[model samples]
Target: MLATLDEQAQAFREDVLAGLSAPIPAVPARWLYDRRGSELFDDITRLPAYYPTRTETGLLNEVMPDIAARIPRGAAVVEFGAGSQTKTPILLRAIAPAAYVPVDISGDYLNDSAAELQASFPGLEVLPVVADFVRSFNLPEGIDSLPKLGFFPGSTIGNFVPRSGTDLLRHFRALLGTGALLLIGMDRVKPIERLLAAYDDPAGVTAEFNLNLLERINRELDGDIPLDAFRHEARWNDILSRIEMHLVASRDVEFSVAGRHFRFSAGSSIHTENSHKYGPRGARLMLLAGGWTPIAEWTDPNDDFAVILAEAQPNRFAP
Candidate 1:
């Protein structure tokens, strides 16, 4: 395995470099989860205004043992985008995985979580893989003997567009192997006002979280994107059942990168993130199409989000 920058990864970076000059303010959503972006997201979750993290964490806390019961014995527990692993120990404690694989790109952050989890769990082996989870992963060779159980909480599944979401889940299912399990957390559709409030919080952590994309570009690509020149915007699209986050340009500007100058219209906008809010029926249908059998699902009393367990479906998705 190339181990990093799979074919898709190579193409995506090329697309972004080309798209940067196409008269629009645009960046792919994957770039927003780098170390700094990850830190900001952790901070965002801690903000009182951010309810999804706390509420979903609470629901998972109550239901994890039952969730663990669904796992086949001696299963390896794997988590994608396993940042600080804030919610991991709960499941790990309950199921007590033979191995815990936390996949993340931030080495420092990933190692810290791995050390803490390994130290606390005593017998469980904590494997920290420091690579972008959006790219394909090579599960460490050590745990191949055990069955796999995939855990992805924090409602991070909502970050993808519908098609991309299903595709990634399919890839995830294949990686986990036959009869493998998938645990997914999703934000469900609700009153538009409530959805809007969650993203556009009073404390502005969400704003920082959204705008961190610019900072990532500035820091990594060596691009000069004046943070103050862009405005963070969030809106609820009732029709699509999604909350769209965007960065709007304050005025016309030109940027140069890799010896290329890209121009943006004065009022242009770059789409940052899309958090798909689904109804229960819709979520189940999506999972079914993606070849996962929705075994158990739970929702908070307020009806804001859902955490679901699904088993791998047949090979490919047609529906």
Candidate 2:
């Protein structure tokens, strides 16, 4: 069942409070997707600097025929995040899933996207579930008997650290059940310059997208944060092999969120998000650790991105 707005808000409030109190202040990237944040993100994808969306979309179009051949007809496709209007349609057209379950935390955006997608695919079942896909949630009834095909695109998996990402994949494996198939996108480890450009776009749309999280906290959680006091900064953490987004305080500043006060010194930052790129072996190893055996993979000529197809094989004892 979808969480009530109050419940969702409370969760957001709790996360913010706890995150701020942590030794290394940071917030989860998922909270960055409130309605306005989602819209900003949609804009970010269109920017010239952001290459993942365009690269992945073109690759999906090219590989759908091969993907379709392997996926059984009438299987239900449960997309982990909000279904992309551009990309989801391509998959729906190719595989013709009997049902498409889009699970996202942004309730309004999820419903709006689901409605538009349902319009496009009149015969398909569109079940929109508003819940954190990272945590447990019940899939809408009636797709239980259908063969399951999990669609996780856009390399959102990169947002989590490797350990969390593996756990998330395992969660998907358990939720989708044994014998289900997963089509996932993984961003490749690319040039540091390209990675920085993608996250720290010249156009500043990425800046706005990053700043919007603070705006969301203020609007939703009674936070009195001075938006101007903080600026968006993106850095490539070489040791971690990830791009980290941080909101740095321009000067010593103090803020109150939900009646709790917090202070930051000049240059202190709240680490907001991470995007971890992967090599071929690392991606496959992570999937295997999460209980999926990769069967096929496709990549662009430049090797900028990848789309991998894996299946949940039955558990067996192996040395």
Candidate 3:
């Protein structure tokens, strides 16, 4: 269900407190999506160094004909983290679903995108839900009558840890029900130099994006973070097979949020995000663990990215 305003605020407060108290202080990446942060992310996607966006888009272009054939006409297309809805038009045009549900944590952006999409596709019913897709929420009216097909593009699943990713997939499985379809993008492991460069671009756009989180905290939570005291850093961990983003303190510093204060020693950092790259075997194993049966997969020519088409696994017992 959608969290109440107070509930959402309280959850944010608790998350901040917990993250600050951890040995490796960190904040949830979702908090980084205030209006400005969302805009910066949209910019990040267009950067020439960012391969996931264009590669995934290319995969969709090549495979949508087959992908659309599997999704029944008039099915409801529900997209998670529907930022800017850039890759959505491809699916919408190809599948021509009865309705479209776009879910995102950024309410304002979500609404704006929904409005633009509705204007572009007059006949398509566009419903934008402003709740975080990670939690349980009510589906839109009339969605229950149609076959639900989930579109989770942009490899956002990489943001979560493995367990959380599995939980999210299970949530989707339950929401979509048996026989529903899921089209998800997964980024593959690539060269460390390439991965690091993607997050730490020369333009400093990503640096601004990372630092903006502090600005957001300062604005919203009455925080007093010295933005200049910290710098954005992205590193690829060979052992973990993920790229990690951190806000490294340039010097000793202290900050407060909602009247509560926290401290950071020189060289200490707040881990912000992780993008885990998966190989084909790992991806399929993840799907099976989450109760999805892999149907087929598509990839770009270089195999740097993938779009997997999977169906909700059928109930094992007899109907």
TM values, all candidates: 0.91, 0.98, 0.97
Alpha carbon lDDT of each predicted model? 0.77, 0.93, 0.87
What's the lDDT of the predicted structure labeled candidate 2?
0.93
Q: Highest lDDT: which candidate?
A: 2
RMSD of each: 2.4, 1.6, 1.9
What residue runs in model 1 are displaced by over 4 Å at the alpha carbon? Answer: 2-15, 22-25, 316-319
Ranking by TM-score: 2, 3, 1
Cα lDDT of model 2 by residue, 231-283, tens digit: 99999999999999999999999999999999999999999999999999999
Which prediction has more favorable lDDT, 1 or 3? 3
Q: Tens digit of lDDT per residue, candidate 1, span 1-115?
A: 3234355345445656866755654566766766677777888888776788898888888887788778877889888876345688888878877998988766666677688
For every model in order, what is the number of clashing pairs? 2, 0, 1
Residue-level lDDT for 318 in candidate 1:
29
Q: 2 or 3, which is superior by lDDT? A: 2
